[model samples]
Target: MRVLYCGDVVGRSGREVVIEKVPELRKSLKLDFVVVNGENAASGFGITEKITNSFYESGVDCIVLGNHSFDQKEIMNIMSSDKKLIRPVNYPEGTPGRGAAVFKTARGKSILIIQAMGRVFMDPLDDPFAAVDRLLNGNRLGSQHDFILVDLHAEATSEKMAMGHFCDGRASAVVGSHQHVPTADAMIFPGGTAYQTDAGMCGDYHSVIGMQKDEPLRRFTRKIPGGRFTPALGAATLCGILIETNDETGLATSIEPIRIGGHLKPTL
Candidate 1:
């Protein structure tokens, strides 16, 4: 199975870029499933139902959320009906949306998508390692599903790498998000899991992460909020990780960082 896991989609520019380029990339790569982190798909905050649907229409099979999952209040109700949309598994039990789901690829292969948020340097939440253990043990991927992909939403690179090692051999791929800067360490782990510390953001690279640079710079310099942060208007890139998994064992055979379009050089 070939799976593509996109990084965080910042705002309008991110969404527009994905909608415009994902379809062609999907076709050219012959992707079996596409999972995207859409926590910031709306406007550098939270995802809306409309934007989530747009991701689906643009060839995304599953949409994962992070700390900003609930920033958009409207998603609280819409998530109840959208099974493809997922929030962090480490969130408390009463969270609105699910953290994991199974999606069938066009070729009929069952792909399990799981989203988990790290607690270090992030909002206090349940233990991500424990949450992932419970989910995987409950689902029994090798027997119940053909492929398993985990999105480790985190701020610290160490935590993301730790989680990837923890899930090695069990998950087909483990990719990180939230920092917005793409890392160069995309490779298949010794135990068969494809891993990357960060898959980067799908928004403009010309700004701070995906927001306008001025506000972030101001906050850093002045230590005060002067104005609301807005999404950068420059052209965006679709950044992600591409993994090819073994058909029988459901383990990753190869992994590559993918960056296409906009100011970033294409990486595959």
Candidate 2:
């Protein structure tokens, strides 16, 4: 199975790149499944219903959310309607949307996607470790599910790495998000699971984590909010990780980093 995991989609540039490239990538990369982090898809804040559907039409298999999951007030309704849209598993119980889901490919192969947010320097949520363990407990990866993708939407590198090691051999891939900056560590673990500290953002890199540089620079240098942060309209660099996994073993055989379009050197 070949899966492509895209990091946070920040805004217009991010959405546009994904919409334009995914279909082409699906064919060129021979991708069987695609997951995108869309927390910041709507103007660098949260995702909207129309934006979500646009992504689906453009070839996204599933969409994941982070701390900014509910920024768009209407997403709550879409979550109840769309099972392919996932929230963080560690969110408090009774949260409207599901945190994980089992989706299938065109060939009927099962792929389980579970998202968990870390507590370090983040919102107070349930134990991410326990949430991940609960999902992987008896759901044997190779036997029960053809592939398993664990998305650690975290801020700290240690937390993301810990999750990868914790789910080693249990999941097909463990990737990080939220920082919107791709890391150099893209490798398959000894247990065969693919890992990357961050897949980066599909937005203009000339800005601060996808937002326009002005406000961020002002806040950083002046220590005061002068204006709202907006998405950078410049050309974007789509960033993500692609993994090739063994079908029978349901473990990653290879891992590759992807960065293309604007700013960052192309890694397609």
lDDT per residue as tens, model 2, 7-93: 899999999999999999999998999999999999999899999999999999999999999999998888878988999999998
Q: At residue 155, what lDDT does model 1 achieve? A: 92
- Tens digits of lDDT, candidate 1, 1-268: 8888889999999999889888998889999988889999888999988898888898888899999999998998888689999999888987777988888888888889999999889999999999999878877556778899889999999999999999998898889999999999988989888999999999999999999999999999999999999999898998988899889889988998888888999876
lDDT of 2 at 181: 96
Backbone clash numbers for all candidates listed: 0, 0
Whole-model lDDT, model 2 = 0.94
- Candidate 2 wrongly placed segments (more than 4 Å): none
lDDT assessment of candidate 1: 0.90
Candidate 1's C-alpha runs over 4 A off are none
TM-score between model 2 and native? 0.99
Number of clashing pairs, model 1?
0
Best TM-score among the predictions, by candidate number: 2
